[model samples]
Target: MSAQQRRGEPPPLPEPLSPLIDAHTHLDACGARDADDVRVLLDRAGAAGVQAVVTIADDLDAARWAADAATWDPRVYAAVALHPTRADALTDDARAELERLAAGPRVVAVGETGMDLYWPGRLDGCAEPSAQRESFAWHIDLAKRTGKPLMIHNRDADAEVLDVLRAEGAPETVIFHCFSSGPEMARTCVDAGWVLSLSGTVSFKNARDLREAATLIPPGQLLVETDAPFLTPHPYRGAPNEPYCLPYTVRALADVVDRPAELLAEQSSDTARRVYGL
Candidate 1:
């Protein structure tokens, strides 16, 4: 059994009121290693109305896995990047390999890469802001060169993330993956035509600001992601997250915007397809 199952698996929520795409998740981290394993996971997600997904990478090996996983099922796609937290890992050899993978079939976005100040101060394997800035810039350039959407991972470094984006000239498609900021940041992003991809955090009682941000997002600018194997939605916050758990977050978001879950799902799924060209 996977660790998630061992940790007390919660059955996938009832089928979503409408079909939705899990814009970001990690099949490898969820212990899905082969085509058969991926099929089982996709089967569960399909049963819950998550008809498609974009599994994201945080490092070279993960990127390689993501590219291959995308081929395992037509329902699956991939995004490749060295995560902000692991920015320092983008070595010369790694970059070339990543470039090769980014251009590979079914690799849609060039991210989950941005800045994170939440890690310990520039030591003990934690990347310093300088290294992260350099890496973020590289990823930005790569996204532009590849003509792929840039999926950003901002954590406690919103200002810096914006600064680099502005300097680099935001990509035609920019995604604030797992948006954890407040109204001010939300407005800035929306005004710039950047997409806000909300995770399960919006369902947390303490995330009043994030919930409010959701309401302000325009229909086409909104997207949903599970960030699975982490950030599981409320009522099961600590349970190992997976694409199948996406319905819970969608329902919570619908409540936040006071719209039917099906409507929100359709809108977000449409935007997801446009952004990722699914």
Candidate 2:
């Protein structure tokens, strides 16, 4: 291979896949080129053994698009809510709109919501903690009213997020969509009976915190997700992620917990079904 080819290495060989769910992904963002594009993506995911998928939309347009996609594909499900960063974007009219959307067939969960302090100073109009808190509260209420799990996305705001959740008496089955927190938070979440959905970062070379957290989590409280077109698991780290790439993450998770990959797959899938009501 040439020098350039060698420098841009491909992901490692994928591990054997087991039946699973891409519990959280942005299918609207990844495969919206056309219907055929979506079909191809679904075909690839199906071939890789992803029995189901819960596609999340951070805004009204994305939510409507995701619902339509689910209509086109039986394997895809939908979740509708304003993301933390875009919380202010939601209008009063959206309440009724989302209520209708949530009632759609296979529409499950109410998130990709929660506090995001990672880019506190960046993103105009997003640095305010109160705004994110209000959004988080709205989502919690949405979950309660709709009877759907709240899929969370916490980044650098763990303590405050937990505090709000506790104060509000959040739903019984909240999920930390892309659980990137350390062992301390993991223990608290597990103790609270919340599901921690692991992502590609678990397979990264320097993800010691994630590995430690994984070790402490009970099997029933654990789940896996690709967060596709985002956290592509190791070996596929630099490439666009898809549901098919889930096995690489599963293999890493299995290694961390010292369980067989197949068992992890089954347990995580079961956990996803139970949490998301899939």
Candidate 3:
């Protein structure tokens, strides 16, 4: 389906709360092609109390764009890496470029990297499992060397991802962006001092397991994100998502964890700032 057809309508903004930060998003994929577009999106977010955002890169071109996009606005930061599906593209030249980008002033993390067993057999051109593991390990080392957080993107390969992290020795800060696992994994990550960045998926009516997991996470170990242009949250599930929509997820998370929305928002934002070193 085309983007327009898939994104039926932009959801109405939720009521503003304490300042929040969207720990993960895709400004380029969300249709912010230039500085002005970036400003417009961020302005909407700011009005809804979203103070900052971290745009994530899933490939070489996106890594370059994310690093540059961070320069577009003070509120924007970046995380750079090749997605597991595109691990084959991480050639020697690409690795050198990513190393350079990871050292950029606005680059805050090295990630969206980890195992993705779900796509290997189902999606054409998806990287083989072996390639994904090799690339994930390289990205982990890059994160450690750069002294930046490791932003992970795990999909149906939780065990494999954890095993690789154990083998490679995880970076000081590891974030499971758009964390989709249940309470068991949540406990495992929390016990290991890794951050779990929850997304709109936690708000779905059918996400009882995720909601349960949310209750298990300590405020300092938790975060909120839009992962926008996807996972638009419950009421607006099929609609296009953006940073401005973060308040909805924050409120939903507050409900799940039985905390005041403003307090949760503040805590999550603080966690984001610390994790990204913003």
Best by lDDT: 3
Q: Compared to the true structure, candidate 3 yields what TM-score?
A: 0.97
lDDT of the candidates, in the order given:
0.90, 0.82, 0.93
Give the range of the ten consecutive residues with the poorest summed lDDT in model 1. 9-18
lDDT of 3 by residue, 1-278 (tens): 34544669788877887689999999999998889999999999998999999999999999999999999999999999999999999999999999999999899999889999899989999999999999999999999999999999999888999999999999999999999989999999999999999999999989888889999999999999999989998778888999999989988888988999999998998898888889
Q: Tens-digit lDDT track for model 2 on 121-227?
A: 87777736788888788889888888888899899999989988988888867999889989999999988888899999999879899889989988888888888
| Candidate 2, lDDT over the whole model | 0.82
Better candidate by TM-score, 2 or 3: 3
Q: List where candidate 3 sits over 4 angstroms from the true fold.
A: 1-7
Off by over 4 Å in 1: 1-7
TM-score top scorer: 3
Clashes within 3 Å, all models in order: 0, 1, 0
